[model samples]
Target: MTPNPTNAPARLGVQLQPQHANYTQIRDAVLRMEDLGVDVVFNWDHFFPLSGDREGLHFEAWTMLGAWAEQTERVEFGTLVNCNSYRNADLQADMARTLDHISAKGGDTGRFIFGTGSGWFERDYDEYGYEFGTVGSRLDDLAEALPRVKARWAKLNPAPTRGIPIMIGGKGEQKTLRLVAEHADIWHSFVAPGDLQHKLDVLARWGEKVGRDVSGITISNELSRGSLDDGHADALYAAGVRLFTLGLSGPHYDDTPVRHWLAWRDRKNREAGVGAAA
Candidate 1:
């Protein structure tokens, strides 16, 4: 397995779930999160609320992303994991490239991150008229689609301002890890601290099979389910997670939990001899 870089500073992220709130509230939350000094901001790709009211106020991911590209001055942004089944691969690439250009302030490269998955939400598929195929079939489709997305990026007119970072979210060892080895710049997973090392071991074998060194791929973990008091954050960091993300629901978009994680991140970075923003 690729060793966790002991010197690397931990980065904080938050997924502003686009449910249970209005557009203005979500917009305000975005601004607040960036102000709170997060390294990245994310949103989920679902048509309905995963919690609370089944028909709560919700917004689409890509369109809001266009707004986010133009709204935030800093902090990378993307979906926590876009459902690959929602759109055509080439169109997705073009949309990502467009956002990349839109996010490019001054002359810097775009900060858009293309975080995607094979999709599993049955309601989304059923309601939206997409095929909720078998998990293996969906994974197979994603494996095919990702390459097309990359190839399209290469052929786009102006091209992306930067090589848009590809973040694949899943813990499936065989197919998902292989795809991560083949394409991902970041791998987002929910593997528990105790299981992290084993997952990393599986990832490494996939990397070897693909003939790609996976050491450069950033390890991302979800911290939304638990508090930092449990020491899970520290354990994930110790294992290899450099990007720690939490999910914030709407209405008020509370920053209390965010501040706690931010403080933890600052402390961790300082201990590593890095600046808070680093």
Candidate 2:
């Protein structure tokens, strides 16, 4: 088994939930986040609002991503976890490639992270007429679709500007962790600080079984639900997490949380002898 190093520099990400906000508001928020120096900007992939009015104003994920590709110049962006049930696997790959190229300006590589997962929202499935398969079946489908997504990237005419980083979300020890070991460049989780160690241990075991090293995979945890000052961020950082994400909702997208986390990120990075934006 390869060494599982936990020395990566701290980075901050914000998930601008695409709900309760008009497109113009969303667009401005994206620009503001980039200007605020966030390392990554993410949006969730669901058709309807995950919170507030269930039928409130919301926008599509991939389309908004395309606009984000055009709007932001520096921050890497993508779905926090795109639902695999909505589109064909091959089509998803192709669309990702197109977005990759679209984001590339001047000579810079595309700042797109292909974050996805086996979807779980039953409402999305019911309203959209997709098969609301059992959890096991959905995992099976994601297991199969990932390879095709990667293969299609290789076959695309221009190809992606960079080896697009794959960020997989979830922490199921059995199937989700296994898939993360096999395919992910980053893994997003909501596990609390105390449970994070066990999750990482499970991920390591999966990596050993799959002949892959899990150390290089960035660990992403959500900050939207917790008190950042409770020493949770410090504990998570101590547990080898490098990428921290905070979810922001609208009609009023608050920047207080973002600024607080960004300040925390800078402090952590500086303590580790790394630049805040590095």
- TM-scores for every candidate against the unseen true structure: 0.97, 0.97
Q: Rate the local accuracy (lDDT) of all candidates.
A: 0.91, 0.88
Q: Please write out the lDDT profile of model 1 over residues 114-187, one tens digit for every residue.
A: 99999999999999999999999999999999999999999999999988999999999889989998999999
Q: lDDT score of model 1?
A: 0.91
In model 1, how large is the Cα lDDT of residue 74?
90
- Best of the candidates, lDDT: 1
Candidate 2 lDDT tens digits, 1-278: 42235667788899999999998899899999999989999999998998889999999999899999998899999999899888999999999999999999999899889999999999999998999999999999999999999999999999899999999998898999999999999999888888888898888899999999877888888874636573888888887778999989987788888889988898887888875574
Q: Over the full model, what C-alpha lDDT does candidate 2 score relative to the true structure?
A: 0.88
- For model 2, give the 10-residue run with minimal summed lDDT: 1-10
Q: Which candidate is the best by TM-score?
A: 1
Distance from true position, residue 217, model 2, in Å? 0.5
Regions of model 1 farther than 4 Å from truth: 1-4, 224-226
RMSD of each: 1.2, 1.4
Colliding residue pairs in candidate 2: none
Clashes of each: 0, 0
